[model samples]
Target chain A: MLKVENLHAGYGGAEVLNGVNLEVKAGTVVALIGANGAGKTTTMRAISGMVRPSKGRVLVEDLPVEGLAASRIARLGLAHSPEGRKVFGPLSVEDNLLLGAYRHLPHFLGFRSKAAADLKKVYDLFPRLEERREQLSGTLSGGEQQMLAIGRALMAQPKVVLLDEPSMGLAPVIVQEVFSIIRRLKEAGITLLLVEQFAKSALEVADYAYVMERGKIAVAGTPEELRKDERVLAAYLG
Target chain B: MDTSVIIQIVVSGAFMGLVYALVAYGFQLTFATSKTINFGQGELVMLSAFFSLTLTRLGAPYWLMVPGGLLFGALLGLFVERAAVRLALEQKSEGWILLTIILGLLGFSSAENIWGRDDHPFPTPISSDPIHVVGVDITPLEISVAVGVLGIMGLIELFKRRTLLGKAFEAVSADRDAAELMGISSTRTVMLSYALSGAVAALAGILVAPITTVGPTMASALILKAFSVAVVAGLESGFGVVVVGLFLGGLENLASLYLGSGWREAPGLLLLILALALRPNGIFGKASIRKV
Candidate 1:
């Protein structure tokens, strides 16, 4: 559903993503695991057109989308839950979710009614979000905010979702809860490209996995194949 | 001085102050999305008023002219965004400041060339005849200003709260990047804001034209005071500008009454300086809290 070929991107002169190539076939979860600065986030940003790739081709279901505006990429069926859970702090949870479906819904009146079904689906996924629907998102706890982020991305009903560090700065218990949500989403057949620091937990949920090192794919295989490899076991699983 | 006279002066001044609030609200609209204000906003007001006056001269009625004038203002706003602000915002530079100022200067000269430098009396259907309420006499012309300013502001506030597009606007204001992730284009939102701001500025010009007259320099003093209103009230709150505008309006009138006509402009400047020195965020503006 999503493909990147020879992606190169960076901040100003410092290149962070160097010829990174990866793919996630439809209806499967792909985990990108690496240490800090492995270019996981940069890869996600380049795919979503947040950070313009100096050299690369990003294709969403065969439509080349590299160098398009982030907003344009979003409209073309890519939802990016960026690192740091960048929710609109002043907006209510319901409003945030409603905005996640912005491209599909009407711009003016009657949008609430049209978005009701999508809202219900997300609310069911995270009951806590429904409870605090009217509350400002910024005031939510880190765990709830993370759920809100995932829930928001789901609201888009996008062709592919890029989940970036869903467990970052979360409690262990909350991290487990987040992983369970991913499992549930996998069962529902959501196509996702997940970026996670928790390699073990990610591999458990991912059908396929890629280990990134210094802005390139160091290893790639099924989770079981990766588990049997010594280099993958020592460098990441250890 | 009779207490009734003081009330009369304050009331009249307060009506005029509503115009300042309307213009300041224009500043708030653009600032909400872009974090930049058009320094040439005064010229926008002047130019829009002149355009409206031309419509009047072309034999259009007040109702027709109002919408016509607002449309012209909205177009001018889009032009300003395209010509002055968009490039700077895209490059992430502060060049918009000088660019907008130059646009304003160009607008000023354009008005001089098109309409001449002389002030002309703005003809209006609304009567200037004062109607007495208890002891205070208020003109229909002034009442129209109050009604027009409040009506537009209330409509805009409703737009922000009730509509999905408006909510998108607020989302962009709150966080530009996050809004983009939702497929809400910040550039379009910013353009919409400028259009709204321009329309609001045009309305201010049209409302005040009968009392102040239509001319190239008509909005000079008005825009300065409106700036004071925006700064003193804080640029974030709609309600803040009205309260500050009214207070500044009344205070200036009282200052002129007691101190002298020469001291009329003093109070607004004083309030602006005091607000800037003491509370730079504005009396109604909340201090932003950053989370690491």
Candidate 2:
């Protein structure tokens, strides 16, 4: 459902993602695992149009999305949950989620009940946010904010969602909880592309795996194939 | 001093405060959107008032002239945003204070050339009839000032809460990147903020013209006090600004009457200092995140 072909993207004078190619089928998780500054976040940003690719194509359902604004890319059903859980700090939890659903705003504005039902669905996915519906999002815990971030992107009703370091700054237990939620999302048929530094945890859930090093994709394989690969074990598993 | 004197001073203060709140609201709008202000806001007011006076002389009715003059203010705001504010953001200019002040001076000088540096007569739409309050007389203009500010505040609240563009604006104000991620055009929202601010400032100038008289540089001191109001109330809280507006107006008037007219503005400013000392975030403002 999504494809990135020979993509090249960078900031300032330095190129961070060079000649990268990847694809994700519907209803599966594709994990890109790498070290810090491995161009994982840069790749996610390029795909979402937060940073445009200098060369190459990004396609969702075979429709080219290069050169679009981040918000416009979001409208094409590709949502991004940023690396730092960048929730709109002063806004209420509910508004933050509604921000995720920007493409759906016109649909909701005409029918209050529809918006309410959507909110109820998000509440079911993460009950804590419902309890803190009126509380400012910045006051949320690391785990809660991560959940809120994912919930916000889900609010967009996107066909593909990008997850960037959902585990960073989160406790091990919270990380497990967030990953479990990702598991639930996969079971519910939401396509996901995740970038993470935690190899073991990411490998367990990732259907396909790609290891990146210095802005280049060094290896790509099925999860089982990568699990047995010697380099994958010696370099990343340790 | 009789109770009558107190009431009359309050009536005057309230009237001036209406214009004060209007001017302060413009400052608040610009800051809330771009985390910047047009210190030239004063020029917008002075120029708008001068334009109204010019129109009145040419036979335009007060109401007809008011909107026309305000459109000029709005245009002025748009121009500043396009040429100055946008340039600052593009170049990542750190000296917003200096740039805004320079713009203010430019605007002031432009109006100075037109108005010839003199005060001119500008009347109000409201009748000049005076109403008695406990044996003290107050004019309808004063009443209109209070009522007008309140009315605009209500309208603004409704617009922000109910409209799609308003909601988009709120989103942008809270988080620029996230708003962009949501498909909101940050450029449009920022320009809208300036437009709203300038329009309100024009309203303030036209409203106060009958009492203060129109002049090229009249809004300089007024804008300073309005900036003080924005500081004391905090730009994030629109409601807090109105409360601060009313309080400062009353305090300024009371101080002038009881202490001395030269020290009239001192009380409001002193109160601002006190509020900032107690709550640096602002009396009703929220504490935003500070990057280390």
Candidate 3:
């Protein structure tokens, strides 16, 4: 459903993502697991058009979307829940989700009623969010904010979602809750490209996984194949 | 000293202050979206008023001229954004500060050349004769200023709260990147803000033109007080500008009455300095608290 080919991108003079290639097929969860500064987030950004790629092709459903503005890329059916849950801090939770569907919904009036079904689905997935629907997103706890972030991305009803760091700063228990939600989303057949610091949690749910080392994909395989690799076992799992 | 006389002075001063609040509100509108404001906004007011006056002279009725002026103002605002702000913002530079000022200077010259340098009276159907209300005399013209200022403010505030596009506007203001992720174009939102701000500035020009007269230099004195109001009230709060505007206006008239007419501009400047020294964030503005 989404593909990045020979992508190169960086800030200023230094290059961060060099010749990185990755793919996520329809209705599958692909994990990009890497250490700090491995270009995982940068790769997600490049795919979503937040950071323009210096050279390469990014295809969302086989449509090239490399050099467009972030908002333009989003309109092409790609939702990116970026690093550090960048929720509209002052907006209400429901408003955040409503905005997620901005590309499809009416711009002015009757948007709420139009997005009712999608909103209901999201509310069912995270009932806590429904409870705090009117509260500002900034006031929510870290776990709730993460849930809001994912729920917000789902509101877009995008063809593919790029989730970066779903468990970056959270307690182990909250992280577990997050993974369980991911499991639910996977079972619901949502296509996802996930970037994570926690390799073990990511590997358990991923259909295919890539271990990134210094901005390049060092290894790619199924979860079982990855578990048997000595380097993957030593550097990440061990 | 008759108590009603004092009431009359304060009421008239407060009416003038509302014009400052409206222009200051224009500043807040653009600041909320792009963190940049048109330094040429004062010229926007002058030009729109001049244009509206021309509309009146061209056989358009007062009702027709108002909307015509507002439309012209919004277009001029878009022009300022395209001509000055958008480029500087794209490069992430403070070049807009100089660019907008230059645009204002250009606007000033254009107005002088087109309409001449002399001040012209802006005709209104409303009576200048004072109406007795609760033992105090007030002019319908003055009352029109208050109504026009508060009315537009209320409508814009309503739009921000009740519409999806308005919510998108707030979203961009809150987090431009996150808003972009939602498919809300920040560039378009910024453009919309400039347009709305332009409309507002034009309204200020129309409402106050009758009292102050339409001229290239009228905005200079008005813009200074508006700046003081925006600073003292903070750039974030809409209601803050009105309250501060009314207080400053009342103070100015009272000062001029007691301390001599030269003191008319003194209170606004003093309050601006005081607000800057004691409360830089403004009395109503909350200290921005964001968790990393």
Question: Candidate 1 chain A: minimum summed lDDT over ten consecutive residues — where?
Answer: A148-157
Error of 3 at B217 (Å): 0.4
Candidate 3 residue-wise lDDT, B141-175, digit = tens:
99999999999999999998888899999999999
Q: After superposition, how far is residue A81 of candidate 2 from its true place, in Å?
A: 1.1
| lDDT of each residue in A111-212, candidate 1, tens digit only | 999999999999899999999999999899999999999988888989999999999999999999999999999999999999999999999999999999
Candidate 1 stretches greater than 4 Å from native: none
Position B201, candidate 2: lDDT: 87
Report model 3's TM-score to 2 decimal places: 0.99
Recovered native contacts, candidate 2: 0.41
The reply for model 2, stretches above 4 Å from the true place, is: A52-56, A61-64, A107-114, B53-70, B95-99, B134-136, B258-260, B268-280
For candidate 2 chain B, the 10 contiguous residues with the lowest summed lDDT are: B90-99
Q: Is candidate 2 or candidate 3 better by TM-score?
A: 3
Order of candidate numbers by DockQ, starting with the best: 3, 1, 2
Q: What is the lDDT of candidate 1?
A: 0.95
RMSD of each: 0.9, 2.9, 0.9
Of all true interface contacts, what fraction is found in model 1?
0.81
Error of 1 at A122 (Å): 0.7
What interface RMSD do all candidates show, one decimal each? 0.6, 2.5, 0.6
Q: What docking grade does candidate 1 earn?
A: high
Residues B1-292 of candidate 1: C-alpha lDDT, one tens digit per residue: 7999999999999999999999999999999999988999999999999999999999999999999999999999999999999999999999999999999999999999999999999999999999999999999999999999999999999999899999999999998988899999999999999999999999999999999999999999999999999999998999999999999999999999999999999999999999999999999999977767
